[model samples]
Target chain A: MRLELGKIFIKDVQFSDETRVENGILYINKEELLKEVSGDERLRSIDVELAKPGEEVRIIPVKDVIEPRVKVEGKGGIFPGFISKVDTVGSGRTHVLKGAAVVTTGKIVGFQEGIIDMTGEGAKYTPFSKTNNIVLVCEPVDNLPQHEHEEAVRMVGFKAACYLGRAGKNVEPDEIKVYETLPLLEQVNMYPHLPKVVYVYMLQSQGLLHDTYVYGVDAKKIIPTFIYPTEVFDGAIVSGNCVSACDKNPTYVHMNNPIIEDLYERHGKDINFIGCIITNENVYLADKERSSNYTAKLVEFLGADAAIISEEGFGNPDADLVMNCNKIEEKGIKTVLVTDEYAGRDGASQSLADSTPKGDAVVTAGNANELILLPPMKKIIGHVEAADIIAGGFAGSLREDGSIEAEIQVITGATSEVGFGYLSAKGF
Target chain B: MKLKPVILTNNPLTKSSLENKYSVLYKKEASLLDILMFARDYVHKGHRLLTHPLMGSIKPNQTPFKSVAVSKECFNDVDLLSLEIIEESILKAEQLIKSKKTPVYTDKVLEDFSLIDFDLIKNALN
Candidate 1:
């Protein structure tokens, strides 16, 4: 039987570049079609190939035709604004609260106990960890899935650390309690102070060879960090050049997925494949609902440690709720969201403001030396405005998901090793 | 159900140019699968080894952050994988294309298919 076929190309207005949108049917002629679809800038570039009346046309499929979406993008404040200092309470000892972290108007805010109460959408802090001074609002235990329970617990750990930091009035670097969910199997000795990351992924998604890229940032430094997943995918044949160059003393995790481990051993790249570690016994089914549940539970299970949910909930409604939970305050913990593409202006503004308050200053990335000639950390701890950072050889681009995506090349700068800047009200 | 499949040719010209010289939404989805399987049937009818595959896999966590270039070799052995997984996945994806598909296509039986779910897509070594 003969078939009629056509294709559609969708180009986002934000970029001048063209993108093809497939699975569209064309009922008109290609010649007449060019004039019909070619006028608007967004639609200006398109290519349509229709089969002859009798020609047999083959159809192909692409995933994510429709999925609940979350946009991850990041933009640093270029101009500095009003700056204030945080008052170090109790001479090194202050009890904190339990609450999640949030971003509002380009600031990251970490609140203390009983500061605010918010549900899914209202303007309040989200809990990144659990705290002793405050209560953590969690998915009701009855209706709670196993995953949400885990996330709640994880937040508890983060909150506990924040509380101890306040109570002890000092938390030694080694004494600080940090929970890393990323699975790291290959351990190379480099920065001893670098926190270990434990990656938790779905078992079904595990492959002998694959290419995976991860972007990260030091919460304290607020700078970007990147990682890749090759052994988990199938045969890792990554095209990009930076893939291999960045693997020096890389930190990765391999789980007990023997099938996947075997595949990586056979077909994996030349890089070192380290040993495996046992975290949660539950296997991620690789289903959406299950993945969401796993992610929520992972965050909850961390018990007051930093919970980074990258893949599963990037653009779901869960993102808003997960990113907005202020339970960290009640728990007296600190939280940060590593987003690659954020939503619109309102969501962006809210996320930024929620993550940091006005007085807080953005420190030099990957640097231990604190900034001098600047106000005290507390006096301007949270009151800072947006920050404009120019580092690495490459320029940074802000994504819709509120994450920074850039091909950054490290360069030697005069001022700070990584570069530190302020984001106060005066700059805006 | 009738399907509409698009053929992506090596002839770069055959690939849509208006967008970034490549095709999107052709990897796996309800609408795309509905169309791809129909075309695969045609390829099967010819009884020839379909060397070049017209479809590929898409990651669930995938976003428009950066454009990914898929290997053409991955397309060669798609039939080695089960089609049932792809077919079953369409049912669960009902909410995604509710506005785009015909009402008759709303059969709940489609939900029974999960193997073909987008998140299930993986790079096959065979």
Candidate 2:
């Protein structure tokens, strides 16, 4: 499979009469975009607003962030099995509204959502801060159940992104990059001298606000499977969960996974970059055992010499990571694990809840418990009271002056286990 | 045949909805630590853990409710791996609770927490 990604670099976003990308600036039609997400009976009301980088704006209780892209020339539309029909994607040309995003906001679970400040200390921690954002502030209908509320907000993000993505249909891309992976036999033969590498992509599917979806199917319902790395570019996988603000992989992260990009960079130069084997992090112990067993078997069956495994969330998923690592290593396949830490506020606690001697090559994505102070912004989107009730927050997290002091866990994607985050360290 | 699973929980939603359907050991006045310790004791008695003790990404101290499942049948010897995980979960919950005070939740927020906990473990219990 091969994919050509056309990047339309967006300079700025503004509310305009028609929703379209013009001269590198994204002009959103608020009324049209609202209508795009309207008619959901679960939503009492929905509103859209623009937030740009370097602005004194703070968006609170954010649920998900998604990039806008259009399938200009592909076998199927974007975001398969989600807002779009389920057709096998990952081939042909796609146009991306680069540097622009759709950020969904609502109080689904008080502690489940995260914060994305467009500027100030909090801005640096979230990747969304750098993108031109279309913020959706939604209110659930009176007495709507929490699960229904989560589903309502989750679909709005996808629908809004799909609506916005149409703007890039006819626009020419500033730059285009092509990615291709041949059939297993041809791929191996294409890189006979290089090491065969595979990626163990773990999806979060524990429950409710802790679930991920592939092709619109709840990941918990699926077993370990193989997928072309390029398929992810067309939204073969997406996040339907938002647990901790720091560690969860939002839809945007899945579409633009950094690990897949790094592997492609050295595809022929160093490693074979054989496709990716996807698995889930289930809450049941037996489910974990079953999934990891299949994952290791798939890696060995692919004749992989090495694999880089990335985890989503922590704690429960840590057990899955350890199992995948140990089982694959037992097959004599080298593995490199990618994950974040929760080493307490003082950084004195053990990094992960589970570990094994086989996990020798590991990369850490900072600590979720590291403390940070966010300065107050002049303008606030969504609700402000959420600061005190969020996961990393305590009773007095929201101060009288409006500033918030809590762990970095309150910031979205601050410690992304997929290497999408900016925090890391060097061992000296 | 698979042995019936025993659920140890402090979540109101779980008890109200699942009690009639499954065997539930509901703790009315238990903190996060209490339920985890209960699961640890069950594991120490040779009951294998069915669900991950630390199931949700929501930290142990942040959410007030918890629900975990353990096998009803017990062996003569304990499963050390199960004991280790439950012990670590208990310690993490204790440390976080001791370091910071749990939030004084609003009535609506409390319902939200209960719903989330039930949704996470309802499949396992069923």
Candidate 3:
């Protein structure tokens, strides 16, 4: 499949009378955007706010971050299954409102949510701090179950992103990037001399509240399967999990996956970017064994000489990561594993819960356990009081002086295993 | 049940949901470590560990509850892979638990953790 992504650069976002993009400014009619994302009875209230780069704003307990995109010409619309019909996507022109994102913030799973600081010492760790954010503070109606609340908030982010994406429909893009992944035989033949390289994509599908979707179906229900690299750019996969904020691949990262982009950049030159094999990280040992075995089979089936395996979340998924690495390596495929560390705060602890000597070529996305001091921002969105009980926080983590001392795990995309964030390691 | 007989868990939700279909050993006050250690003992006794001990994204120290699926029947020989995994998971859990900043969840938050812990193993119970 082939895709032409028209990039509409949005440098600034502000509430205006009309909702449109003009002169690189994304003007939002707050009322209209809310209406577009509202009507979910489970959500009692929805407030739209904007946080630009270098602002004194903090979005707490962020659920998911999504890039606003419109399918100018594609087999299917954006967010297939959730927002659009489940038609096969990944062929045609899609307009991306790049540099801007829709950030969903609330107490979905309470402690597992993330925080995004627009301008502060914390901003350096998260990629979202750089994006012009359209913040949705969604409050669930009383007595809403966690599952339903997660569903309601997840939809709001998708709907608002879709609504805002319409602004880039007719407007000409600042730049256009073309991404294509042809049939296996053709792609391999196109670069016959180059080494065949494939990507083993692991989705967080542990269970409810830690789920990912492919064509709107819970990924836990699907086995390891092949996917066109371009399909992901067209919104074929999305994050529905409220895993720890630091490493979860928010929908925006899926749309602009750096690994895919980098591989494509070297496509036809250094290596043959054959395809992507997506597998779920289930909570079952049998499922883990089955999925890893299937993943290895698919990698070997592609005749891939090498593979780059990336994981989402940590702990339980670390086992999945190791199993995939070992199985693929045993199949004679050189594997490069990308994951973040939960090493001790002093960086003097074992990195992964599981490991394989076969995992020789590994890329570390820094450590999630490293502590940081985030000076409180002047403006706060969502609940700030959640800091003390957050995943990376302890009792009294939120200081009375408005500053927070916690692990980078509380920061969104701080240690993104997909290599999406700024924090990573370099061998001395 | 595909692999059944024992659902070693601390979450009542998982036990209540699977008790009829499977033999559940529910421990109401069991910590994450306790549940894993019990699963290890069962593994040593020759019962197969069905699901991954570390199921949820919640770190062992972060969430107080855990539910492990183990086989009902026991053999004279223990599964080496099961033993290795349960050990590694326990080791990882221990490291995090000793990190010196464990979470102290309130009753409301504990309920959320209970559901999350249950959700992680619900599909694996099958």
RMSD, every candidate, angstroms: 26.9, 1.3, 1.3
Candidates arranged by DockQ, highest first: 3, 2, 1
In order of appearance, the predictions have TM-scores of 0.23, 0.98, 0.98
Candidate 1 deviant stretches above 4 angstroms: A1-117, A120-428, B1-15, B18-78, B94-126
In angstroms, the error of model 2 at B95 is 3.4
TM-scores, chain B, all models: 0.25, 0.93, 0.91
Candidate 2 regions with alpha-carbon error over 4 angstroms: none
Over A1-428, each residue of candidate 3 has an lDDT whose tens digit, in order, gives 88999999999999999999999999999999988999999999999888889999888989999999999986889999999999999899999999999999888766666889999899999999999999999999998999899999999999999999999999999999998899999999999999999999999998878899999989998989999999999889999879788888999988888999999999998999999999999877888899999999999999999999999988889889999999998878899999999888888888888877888889999999899999988999999988878888888889998899998999999998899988777883
Better of 1 and 3 by TM-score: 3
Pairs of colliding residues, candidate 2: none
TM-score of the second chain of model 3 compared to its true counterpart: 0.91
lDDT of 2 by residue, A287-360 (tens): 89899999999999999999999999878999999999999999999999999988888877778878889999
| Local accuracy by lDDT, each model | 0.20, 0.89, 0.89
Candidate 3 segments whose C-alpha is farther than 4 A from its true place: none
Model 3 misses residue A340 by how many Å? 0.7
